[model samples]
Each structure stands twice: as C-alpha cells, then as structure tokens.
Target chain A: MTLEAGTTLPTQTFVVRRADLVRYAGASGDLNPIHWSDRVAMAVGLPGVIAHGMYTLALAARAVATWTDDAEVLELGAKFTAPVVVPDDDTGVSVEVAGEVASVEDGRATLRLTVTSEGQKVLGMPKAVVRA
Target chain B: MPVDASLVGRTYPPTRPYPVSEAKVRELAATTGADWDGGPVPPTFPILLAFEAMNAFLEAEGVELARIVHGDQKFRYERPLRVGDVLTAALTVASVRSIGGNDVIGTTSEVRDADGALVCATSATLVHRGGAA
Candidate 1:
C-alpha cells in the first residue's frame, strides 16, 4: 500500500472495559491500583477507575499495525492529555483512533494520530513513524 | 510531598534481565484485542521493562503508586523486540517540575538486550498528585 502524504487510514475503535484493564495490568506488570480500584482512584482525585495510558496507547499501536500490516515501528509516543474514566458496567468505554499519513519519505511513513475517548481528545501529539 | 528537583539526572541501576517469551507477548497482545501469530511483538511491549525500572525508582523515593498518574510516554526503537530477547531497563530522571500542586516528573528508560545493546529508549512523564497537607 502506497501511503502517500495526506493519506487517511481507516478509523478504528476499541472498547476498554475494566476487565481489559485488569488483563493489561497483569500483562504489563503495572499493578497500580488506580487502574482497578475505584476507591483509590477517587482518593487520588481521579474521576474513577481509569484505563492505563499505555493501554490506550497500545490500542493506538494496534491500529497502526493493522494499517501497515505490522510494519516495524521506528518511533511511537503520546501525552496523556485526559483520563479515560472507565465505568463498572460490562460495556465499558470506547476509544477511537484515526490517523493520517503526514509524510512518506526516506523509506518511512510518519503518521499523525488523533485518539479520543467520549469525544474528548485523550492523547496530546500522538504520533508514530513506521517503515513504509 | 513534592518530588525533589535534585532527583533530576539521577540514573537508577539497570533492572534484572527479563526474558521475553512468546506466551508473554501473546498475553500482552491479547489484552489489546489482537492475536499474536508469532510475528513482531507489539510496539508498546517494552513498557514491561520500563515500568519495572520506574517502580524501583518510585519505591526508593517513597512515592506512592496511587498518587502517581501517567502523563506522557514516548518510545524510539533501534529494532522491534523478538521473543527470546532477554532485556533490562535502566532509568534516568530526565526532568522535574511542579504544576498545580502536582509533581510532573520526566524519566527516560533504556531497554537493552542481553548483549547490552540498546533496543528501545522509552521516556515517561509521571504526574504525582500532592497529598493534602
């Protein structure tokens, strides 16, 4: 696939339930209670149990992998601009990821990503560079 | 308590070598709703090592896990991680500042292979919420 500049990749949405966070906590070894315990989250001034920022960022990487057929990622980064407050319901919340190829040069494609939860941007300057 | 600004530039000891296994990669990929077919591991997989290094840094500094929130993260890779690559992470305090009663601490962790070759360099910004005094 020729990812030319200004190319828009297909948008992908991923559900982030509490169970997923628990699994992510175990998988990533981040065992921080703020991701699972609502009481601790509130005591720490959070809205409630929040998803791990790396978990959300992982979803973003999953999207990129789908777009590039799992191309080797040269760089990936983002800022946690907002919390993805996950509810106790089974449905949980959804995080939407959209990307546009900003440039394609030097055998690498730079993708500018927009990641959101509940219609609010959750990552500041989320971006990735992958082998084209 | 605010994180000491003097902690900047401090480098923590490298973590013990962590063996990368296919099952571990599959576990991490499964959490993100992806099936690992034994291909390249997920880009964010190195967080396993980085978080370990960060936890040691926080523990030695007496920082509470609940009071800290992730603020930012970045990863630059020398190569994609493969199964059987035993790795270690050494963390360095990159920067520290206060904002709205929160200590925003910047840290960089170098993930290296068994040969001590850098595989990926990941950076994180942790926001520590100040407790009620």
Candidate 2:
C-alpha cells in the first residue's frame, strides 16, 4: 500500500474496563491505586478510577501497528491531556483513535493521531512514525 | 520539596541485564490484550524495561510510588526488541517543575542490549501531588 500524506487510516476504538486494567496492572507491574480504587482516585482528585496512561498509549500503539502492518522502528509519543475515567459498570469507557498520514519521507510515514474518550481529547500531541 | 532540579541530567548506572523470553512477552501480551506471533514488535512492549528502570529511579530518589501520576510517555526505537535479547536500562532525569503543590518530573530511560547498544529510549513525565506542599 502506498501511503501518501493526508491519507486517513481507518479509525478504531478500544474498550477499557476495570478487568482490563487489572490485567494490565498485573502484566505491567504498575499497581497504582488510581487505576483500580475509586476511593483513592477520588481522594487524589480524579473523577473516578481511571485507566492507566500506558494502557491508553498501548491502544494508540495498536492503531499505529495496524496501519503500518508492523510495529518495529515505530516512534510513538503522547502527552496525557486528560484521564479516561472508567466507571464501575460493565460498559467501560471507549477510546477512539483516528490517524492520518501527515508526511511520508525516506521510506517512513508520520501519522498524526487523535485520541478521545467521552467526546474529550485525552492524548495531546499524539504522533507516530513508522518505517513502513 | 520540589523534585530537585539538580537531579536533571543525572543518568543512573545501567541495571543488570533482563532476559526477554517468549514466555515473558506472551505474559505481557495476555495481560495487555495483544496477540503475539513474534512478527515485527509491539510498540509499547519496550515499556516493560522502562517501567523497571522507573522503579529504580523512584527508589533512588526516595519518591513514593503511591503519590505519582504519569503525565506523559514517549518511545523512540532504534530497532525492534525480539525475544531472547537480554536488555538493561539507565534513566536520566530530564526536567523538573512545580505546579499547585505538585512536582512534575521528566525522565528518560535508555534501553540497551547485552552488548550495550542502544535499542530504545522511553521518556516519561511523573507528577507527584503535594510533593512541595
């Protein structure tokens, strides 16, 4: 596939639930209570138990990998603009990721990504460069 | 106290090598909901090493894990990390700032192969609430 600038990759959304966070915490060894305990998260001034930033980042990573058909030599970056609050319900928050090729050069393609949850952007300055 | 700005630019010694095995990567994949066929690499997988390095950095700086909020994360790779490649990580504080009684610290972790070749660099920002309150 020839990726040119302004090519919009198919968008994807990922669900982040409490159970998913538990698995991520166990796998990533990031046992921060804000990801699991509502009381702690509230005490810390968050809306509620929130998803881990890395988890959200991973979702974006998946999008980039899917677009390029490879994950190697991919540079991914994002600033946490807001937390994706996961309520205690079975219907967890859905994170939407949309990417477009901003540029292609030297056999590399740079993708600009927008990540949103609940109609609010959660990741700022999101960008991914893949050696497609 | 605010994270000492002087800490910026100080790189810790490389940690002992960690063997990356298929089982370990698979375990991480199962946890993160990713399937592993061992092609290319998972973009966020290098964070496994970076997270370990961050732990050592927090310990050495006397920072409490419970007080931290990850604010940002970035990964730049020289190559894909494959199974069986033992790796080490060294962290360097990149910046520090204080806001509303919170200490925002920027850190960069360098992941190197057993031969000391750079494999990837993960940068992160950690916000510590009431650290200077």
Using Cα atoms, each model's DockQ against the true complex is 0.95, 0.70
The docking category that best describes candidate 2 is: medium
Best by TM-score: 1
Candidate 2, residue A50: how far the Cα is off, in Å = 1.1
Candidate achieving the largest lDDT: 1
Q: Each model's C-alpha lDDT?
A: 0.94, 0.85
Tell me the tens digit of each residue's lDDT in model 2 across A12-97. Answer: 98888899998888888888899999998888778899998888988888777777776355688899989999998899989999
What fraction of the native alpha-carbon contacts across the interface, defined at 8 angstroms, is recovered by model 1?
0.97
Instruction: Provide the TM-score of chain A alone for each candidate, in the order shown.
Output: 0.98, 0.95
**Clash count list over all predictions:** 0, 0
C-alpha lDDT (0 to 100) for residue A107 of candidate 1:
94
